[model samples]
Target: MHLLRRISTGGIALCAAAVTITACGSENSGGTTSHANGKVVLSIIVPTHTAPPTAPHAISAVRAAATAINAKGGINGKQIEIRTCNENGNPNDAVKCARQAVSDHSVAVVGSYSNSSNQLIAPLVKAGIPLVGFNAITPADYACAVCYTFDAGNTLSFAGMPAALRASGARTVTAVTLDLAAAAANVSAVEQAAKAAGLQTVPPVKVGVTSTDLAPAVQAVIGSKADAAVSVLPTEQTTAFIRAADQAKAPFTFGVVDAQVQSVLSQFRGTQGDHVLAVGAYPPLDATAAYPGLVQYKTELDAQEKTGDKDAATRDSISLRAWLSVHVVAQAAAGITGDITAASLNNGFRTAKDIDLYGIQPKWTPSAKGHVPGFDRVSNARVFFMRINNSKLVPAKPIAGLDLNTGKPF
Candidate 1:
């Protein structure tokens, strides 16, 4: 598949459509400027209105986290301001936001809603601003000259979901993909894993990113008659797919990857999902005590919203990873005594060997081989596979005596 994606600081233009994120940042908009406060203001950008209520709440959680970080003397004692825009979950919008983010001369930016983040690398570099956000870049896309992305390296997604399936003792599997980047990676990786596990393969099926009608895909999955079924589509689409799959009553079990699992369960919470199971890559944020940073974030979110009863907390990897992205810039910026220009940020990456995210995620920096940087150590890969258990998520353990490297069941 070939696509001509125009990426710049103005915005990400997908095909002929031009999209721009809602200019809701808390920083000054400019190309180049001098700062006297010694304060490095960072803009936080993301698609806010892409998926209905969920996207907004997710965006708010990230903003809240940034606000919390700022209150606590922010990175290098610099006060952080968050400028945001609605990507509308559109790639064009993503590119546009990134262009504005880079050209506006803000101290880096955080943004994404899956592939939306991938749409802006070209423009981000053109604007000469550092873009530190979460986007599960393809192992190959990392080679792009324009991509200086700082991934959080919380590995395991559809990447690990297939392993979970093999561990479950399923011998045959059929999977569906949205035919998008991340989803395709999951499907391909899972298929490879299945073959490695000596499982049967069913021809792949595809879906569009914006597809809400999954009846055809559901029927296809149910008719495949494999022992296991998996879908690596976005959360909302996964819901539609799951609902249809459940209705199809396929004998094989159904599974999902990452937060889409949460979204699936949350979407169909309290309903019989035909005993469907969802797998996620990260350690469940809500399963444990809120990351000590979460409380501060909550307080800041409350202050921003001007409400007292702020009950919702940020328990997803996106916001946490975003918060870490800012810290990364701060940490890297601390090393330089000069102005925090995009060039300086890039220079910091070039010079800094490995930037530790203080365990927030993993440390990353630009290397000669790969353009973008982040923790790549196998041990640093802290993705603990988990599955939805009893309507909630639980850690999934590898089979006993399994070859850790091969990930084979004993």
Candidate 2:
């Protein structure tokens, strides 16, 4: 039997069994096109009610991308229209947004942030709509055949921590995380990766997600004898831990997932903020010359801000990822010679050999079989490192591409 299956749909062949003609409906099926309006509609779903104060910035980035694309003669000459939905940081609401995308005949759901992939994936796949540039918060984001996530998310960053710490001259590392199943899984993955790199890892110290006091976690880190500490906690917890570490005079080098570093740095200044590593999926947004996508993003965002959008000026990993996602959608649609429908977009994505988001992310090519184990759908495991210096984040190292499944540098 062939390891890969060929699925035929609308006279186009797809390479994987995970994608099907029935699931990715025919383009001429009169599904989501606005016949009267002649507009290609896309949807962006985000969590406005949930975590990450940067959620609003993500939404604003989507709007900015859409506006800029429209000004440049939209996808395939049809002016693009973007529909925004708030997932409310809940599974049921994610389902609602997915259904709305289907009902509205959206070509694709681009660059939305939600952890409720269990509820969102099935509906989107059944509707023949792809979730492009999705945040890989759950297993579904990595395993769902129709879902395409460009960046590796925090898991890859955590997996790469051991090597990063070793490079920083640390022989032993300790992890501080919340007492959640996901947190435990992340710590375990990091431990395995660190061990593969020949670095000793201490057992993870768990704390309550809502606990404001991090003195115990700080003390535990100091007592663990680890030379470095990694935090997989949310923004508030990370900030609390940093402050606690400073107060306790913990001497270990510290790092947090790139997404939370901005929040943590915003609360600190000068040398106090220095030395805190922020590991992430993409390069620092400050390196605009290296990543032209950042320049485009800032330009569009500045335009939106001039129009009085409060969140437009907010540039962070969340917003940058969202901006990259929309650009990918436009790039795919622009390559298609025919109508830019859901099926065509899926085909374009599957057949795409090189998807470079103007240096915002590494080159990506989707696969029928996953490039990494567990995250069978993810295509790349490249990580970028940044260090907080004087209240600003600066690049610490060039991008490191890794085979996360093997915990080896790619």
Candidate 3:
């Protein structure tokens, strides 16, 4: 398969589009450039009004992080000012967001998500602004010099799915993906990963985009007689399939489900979701008390919620990634001797060997050598394999993370 061959040569881009995230956008807007009273300008570009409508959570996470930092003297006395733009999943809009970040003199773009990230990287690179903690949706994100991704992208999640399922005592696993031409590569990647893990792979069951009734798809999984089922569908379809599977009482374990559907499925206790497994870019949202940073994050979120911020407490892959992204930039800028500008912050990100994210994620080194040949910008390659227990997400493995490219526990 192409994904396996790429693993032998470079890295694979499989499953990059498997997940959809929200980003903010507008027709013509720029970040705040007026830097008075020692303020550090940061911008986040995300998609809003897209499918799943979760970009607002990411925005709230960034705001919560900034609010917390500012309350205790932000980044060595420089106030953090965040500017947000809606990319709306459009390449042209993504470019405009990057241009706005440049024109507004943003030191960095932090914790943003968009499928059109391929269009967002170039202008930021030319302007010497570091792009921090963005959802790695495109090949450009993995290779760009200034792009620092704190969490493993979907590429890593797809590569690691088979091993995660195999650990759950599955002898044979079947994949269920959206019926798109791009999803073919994702299935191939899963096949290769399953082969490496000594797990048998059944032919995938593909669902149409507009299919309303998921009864046929549910029956397909039961008929395959696979020990486990890995779903690579969108939020709505995944939700529908889970409901159908629950109604059917399918015997196979749900080895993988969309992380975006966690919030939706958390309410269904003792159902199919109880055994639903998830591969997340960050730690499971339900394990808030496990990390000290997350405890602080939740406290700030509560404070924001009291002030009428609706999505303040929203916890998902995108929200956690965005929250950590802002802190990564803040920690890097904390030690800057002189003025903090785009050039200084970019240089700081490049030179800073190990950036501390307060245990929300592993320490990231932007200057570290790339483990995979084509994915030079992958600062951290750890992804958590989690399961839902009593509607709460907990670790599937004894270890916290797996090497995303290899599916080996780290």
Global Cα RMSD, each model: 8.9, 7.3, 5.0
Judge candidate 1 at residue 25 and give its lDDT. 24
Off by over 4 Å in 3: 1-38, 370-373, 397-400, 405-410
Instruction: Give the TM-score ranking, best first.
Output: 3, 2, 1
Please, what is the TM-score per model?
A: 0.70, 0.85, 0.87
Residue range 249-284, candidate 3, lDDT tens digits: 887777553455666856666866765777766776
Give candidate 3's whole-model lDDT.
0.72
lDDT over C-alpha atoms for residue 90 of model 2: 82
Give the candidate order by descending lDDT.
Answer: 3, 2, 1
Model 3, residue 293: C-alpha shift (Å): 2.0
lDDT tens readout by residue for model 1, 1-410: 00000001001111002112222122222244224456665655655553542444445655665666677777656676666666666678777777666555576665444454446555655555555654543432233332344541323333444445656666778877876665554565556655644567797778877788898887776677687877666667777876776666656666665556554455554443544555433455544352354444445556646643232343465655665566566667678665666666666666775776543334555553321122122222233445555456555555311212223232
Task: For candidate 2, write residues 1-410 as lDDT tens digits.
Answer: 01011100100111111221122222233245533377888898887764564377787888888888999898888887888888888889889998998888888888788767667777788777878888765544555556777777755555556555665677888788899885655676556555656668888888997899999998888888988888878888888887787777778888777777665566776456554777777776787877777887888889989989987777777888888888888887778886778888887888886777776766777753444545566656666666776666777754333444334442
Candidate 3 all-Cα RMSD: 5.0
lDDT of 2 at 306: 90
